[model samples]
Target: MSAARHPWWYDAVVYQVYVRSFADGLPTGEGKGDGIGDLPGITSRLPYLRDLGVDALWITPFYTSPQKDHGYDVADYRDVDPLFGTLADLDVLLETAHGLGLRVIVDLVPNHTSDQHAWFRAALAAGPGSPERARYLFRPGRGKDGAKPPNNWDSIFGGPAWTRVPDGEWYLHLFDTSQPDLDWRNPEVGDMFEEVLRFWLDRGVDGFRVDVAHGLYKEATLRDQVRPKKPKKSAESMVERVLNDEPMWDQPEVHEVYRRWRKVLDSYPGDRMAVAEAWTQTAASMAMFVRPDELHQAFNFGWLGTPWSAEAFADVITDSIAAVSAAASAPTWVLSNHDVERHPTRYGGGPVGLARGRAATLAMLALPGSAYLYQGEELGLEQVDVPPEARQDPSWFRTGQPGRDGCRVPLPWAGDAAPYGFGGPDGTQPWIPQPDDWAALTVAAQEADPASTLAFYRRALAARREVFAGADEETVASAEGDLLVVRRAGVTVVLNAGTTPVALPQGEVLISSAAVPGGLLPPDTAAWVR
Candidate 1:
């Protein structure tokens, strides 16, 4: 699709804001006030985002919840959570973001709802076989004494996927026990989510980031997971096994739900759209989520999950671009987000990691589709090792895993000390403590340093707008000596993953992740040349 005909999201660069860690506005309880980030705090930071050059902001779930699984276990989809702010605060945020020319996309959790949600509560109160109970996946036990779970599937957060209630019926909860998966087969479920989508669109949200978009539907037969020859140990490996043709995930029926949702988004004005957080095993399967009549964009995690090598990057990018193009939808690239370890840390931690991360950022921006930047990435922030006592992610408790607390540490906006101006005027401590060593990495520090990572991001983003705004064509020039060269529009981006520097193609330099010495791109560096 051409830029003129496609929606703004097609060429947009989106920033993912993890709300609780972004900033704190209304501090109301203990320790210099509650210290949890709120909608008002996000509103107050609109100018910063606009200056950052992101076309839109995708805020993580801030809906009413009981704090289980953070805000992902939403109890009410229509209202904002008290921990974040009131519905009015969201209105102010939406208005302010729009005023600053930044679109806002909120998280939409359709696969499940918190056990405390009104419908779930009613389902619990009603007897088995009641219509209210039918809203969720409540099934009878399978054993002769009705003692065993209906299926042998495991929860993503660890433990059996089925949780037995007081009524002796088992309910499916793919994540946490408090987050019961909804039965999308029911017409009420689909209608409710459609209305939910309209409710937010009516409130002026630009679009939605559909959470677990591949998981809304499951196989009709709740069969046991097909076991592998050898059991996977680590959480990551186990997840990979489950995501590959699992009965409960990436079901073909899920497309029907998005086809209907596409109509809802289309009915709204202002080019509203939805991006799916679908996790499929292959690029083609991921592409299916963004078919013409489905979501506008689906995250290209194949690119995200690829190893730091020129060949690996080229293969994934080639496949991703081809798949999405075939589906007649724009591809979406994401390097870091709330759920994973920051790319900086993942690339190899410390200075080397930061260099690779910066290079990766430029390479991602050079692509011919939308990109998503996690908060704090521009500051070259590395994952902070939160003390075990300070970790709040439910995955840590459920799986005995370290969880995602490291990536969710509060952003250091300014100041040289802890909290780092992340809180309100009272200088409250952030929910998760910031590392004292991050003084030099604060936005204030980076803004003053022209050669800082933050500055590089600003220049790269600005250059992208100038050179590749409507440029969709991308051709792989060459992959030689661990260096990958890609030509997009009239701009050539050279990424060197090798240990030694490499000569750049003949062109004027538009931007570089690092200073080019002797007209050669340094190792772990990337540059855009016109």
Candidate 2:
């Protein structure tokens, strides 16, 4: 964060685009005619995002995939999927986004590839002991006939982690069966990934968001994962259960992979960087991914999961700053992403939730580091309750889990009915249906309302750019019951997380998450003061 060495991303606000649900370019449904979001749709939305005040865009995978886990399972690294659009469409997106003053970051799913990827297909046809099979994790099952899986590990999406082949070998897929894990122990895998990095960099993409950044390597022994005894009636918090320091994620060897990737990024111009999606046991553990020689940033999930309380926020923020700063890297924060329920829904799912979400964002933007804004968050969109039959996330079909379709529902760009302004004026049904209530949250509607959530975000981001973006340190001005306050550069951020109001300090209020009545920060409200 030093003046001479500071990178553009150090204080940037990045927007995450879950491409398939973001927008649809082809009014006629480009490839599959499925009406899914595509590169063209993104290109058209560039000006809107640039105007929204984000410094960069982190676009999720749209690579050649079977769509089993949406785009996380890659069938081909070098080409675009037909269901999304074409390579030409992608080039147009990159060119347009760059022209709009946006840095585009695509996703890199190194943990696994689609079962249909050439390497995996060749591996299957190469039989049990062939070199092609060595590129992936293929282990012999247990028992005399090898009918049982090799270990007790389970997939992140649920069910057994290993899937059997007709050739009598069980392949590891920490996610879904369609995405077989690659063997990072093999030099070929690393070399190929390096080439993939160069291909996109050469194509002018800003960087990559490394998926499951902690999961490229597993324990060498491939030992059975240790398990804690089942608790009585779901006592463990969702935050604790997520990632869980599980055997499948956050391995020490993963750091080496990122160190190499950092070198690749550094070789390129325009201050290219990579942000890791690494879920670790604590903020301290998460910081390992962003060491100077490794990635530029690691998502601070421990901070993201902290309860809506003054105490929880203070403790998590302290640990996040200390650990990340120790690594000489800035902390990256996020509230909602494609994989999680929208924050408004998580906060409490009504007027209270929306208020809390806005306050939380103001506090996040007040912090002295980079932050990620999930698409639709600016409009205060909540997770839709997708019906079972309409659900598309593989996790739902595989494990009967609620799945992520609720958050991945197609965006409501405009219009008051189905499809919104997503595809085009002559749009068809969306991939995942948008709820009826989203008409009130469309960008067009909010753009005209000063009190709208969208307007609130725009103002907050502008104020940050003007007041807080350059500051690299924060000191706690106050952290008492129902209130937390932090000072950065001369600005004070006050958050009232408890019921009732807390009197604000005597200073000119720069911006407030909501209307502050009688100079008091109301419950679930946050404000920045000069």
Per-residue C-alpha lDDT of model 2 across residues 1-530, encoded as one tens digit per residue: 45456788898899999999888875453443356888888888999999999999998999998889899999999899887788889899988888888999999999999999999999999999899999999999999899999999999889999999987899999888999999999999999999999999999999899899888999888988877566434645645565454667788888899889989999999999998888777677788888889999988887667788888888877878889989988877899999998988989989999999999999999887899999999999998999898899998988998899999888887888878787765657788878878888899889889999999999999998998756755555457888888888888899999999989989999999999988989999999988
Clashes (candidate 1) = 0
Clash pairs (backbone) in predicted model 2 = none
Among these predictions, the greatest lDDT belongs to 1
TM values, all candidates: 0.96, 0.96
Off by over 4 Å in 1: 27-33, 231-243
Instruction: Give the Cα error of residue 236 in candidate 1, in Å.
Output: 20
Q: On residues 149-168, what C-alpha lDDT tens digit does candidate 1 reach at each position?
A: 99989999899999998889
For candidate 1, the lDDT comes to 0.89
The lDDT for every candidate, in the order shown, is 0.89, 0.88
